[model samples]
Target chain A: MNPERMYDALDRITRVRGVRGAMVVSAEDGLVVGEAVMEGVRGNAVAALAASLAARLGRAAGAAEAGAQRFVHLQAEVGAMLLMPGADGLVIVAVTDQHVNVGLVRLEMQRMVEDIA
Target chain B: MKARVVEPWLLAPVERFVRESGARLTMVMTPSGQVLAQYGFTRAVDVMSAAALGAGIAASTGEIVRMLDEPDFRVLNHQSAQHGIFLGRFDSRRGPLLGLVVYGEDTSIGLVQLFFEDFVADLEEAAPAETPRGPVLAADFERDLNESLATLFR
Candidate 1:
């Protein structure tokens, strides 16, 4: 995986308005390899949960004949999570508020994944 | 957690979402990681893991909101060279439901979004969610974890 490019992608996500934090995680085994965050956001916890979710969903997706799991996003009353598979076993996760522009985030994340994968 | 066959009326739309979106897999589950209905998952363990993680992230985000006093986040989307995924929540009479879609080179995120909205509407109408359940007990967690691990290996 391209470490430099990963940092760049994470930087862009963190810069978005309402985004609390972002991290690069290992999809195979839940772990955060790299991260960036704004105040009040816990990068470690986000990475662990995001990575686990992606991994879990990836397996289900595979069984359902859905092919390889690619992207994951979670929305709630309070916030949201965006996860993208990166180079090797790495997955990128971003935490954002309700107001964040999802279209723009997806577009950038798409490019970032391409660069790192 | 448990798995249910998302109401029969909702199957048509769910099927349509996969067929039209060219998505390989899709899942409608609870925030706490319980599978309501799933497409393309061959193993139960995988579904178990997905639901747990999806719900875990949602729950963890809630923690962030409690600490910061800001509104919670919404809508999460991710993409890779070969696949794309989208996760979102919508309320039903039952409560809140999480929708997850995974697509590959054959489709785009825009297409997935289009179908996901349709699926959500159908889901709400057919499966009016019940009141949310309480937290999973510690003992249940351990038992569930062991079961999922065994399934993953097999």
Candidate 2:
């Protein structure tokens, strides 16, 4: 995958309305391979959290129907965590305002995932 | 072959079940935001986007209550005069969260949870043996719902 281009795409995405920042992480390692955002947003924490969340969601759940999870979203009153798959060993992370146009954000994030993949 | 490619086969049935359950939108996701599949509403505003928002809530909530011995999730079910939003956690290959939104007042919480549980079981049992072939995208699984949602909301 083109790391540099991915960073550019993330920067552009996070710049959209209500987006605070974005990160590109290695889902397997929980490592913050790249990040772009405002102050106070911990890139590492986001990466680790995303990785952990991915692991928890991707590993195995008894109730999970017979299929792979397409994506996971954790919503908070303050903000939201947006996780989308990247190429092997990677995931796209976005922290956005609760009121942001979620549809637009999702489309952009999905577009980015496709581009990176 | 990219084993993880997202495809419609993984999403169609889930969508049908969600709509049949009376939810305006239903999203099957990983705990982190990877979308397993979705049903109901297709527009950009459909469940796929909402799952992104909801999954974040589940994770943050899961972290805070883990101290209290809650099992890694905070199911948020809010009911009022107008609408209801029910959130719960489900584990597949990876344990993901499921969110269901009822547009109008539909207080059958028991039914909602049961429906979710049933689908989760089906997903686990029916999971494709070979890893999917392609980098999975949320849209691939959410196409019908996205279209439906757009039509409804518009």
Clashing residue pair totals per candidate (backbone < 3 A)? 22, 54
lDDT: worst 10-residue window of model 1 chain B: B1-10
Docking category for candidate 2? incorrect
For B63-124, candidate 1 gives per-residue lDDT tens digits of: 88668987664567777777777777777666777877778755555456656666777676
- Give all candidates' CA lDDT scores: 0.71, 0.65
Best by lDDT: 1
Per-residue error at A10 for model 2, in Å?
Answer: 60
Alpha carbon deviation, residue B19, candidate 1 (Å): 1.9
- Deviating ranges (above 4 Å) for candidate 2: A1-117, B1-6, B45-49, B94-97, B130-154
Show model 1 residue runs off by greater than 4 Å. Answer: A1-117, B1-10, B62-70, B128-154
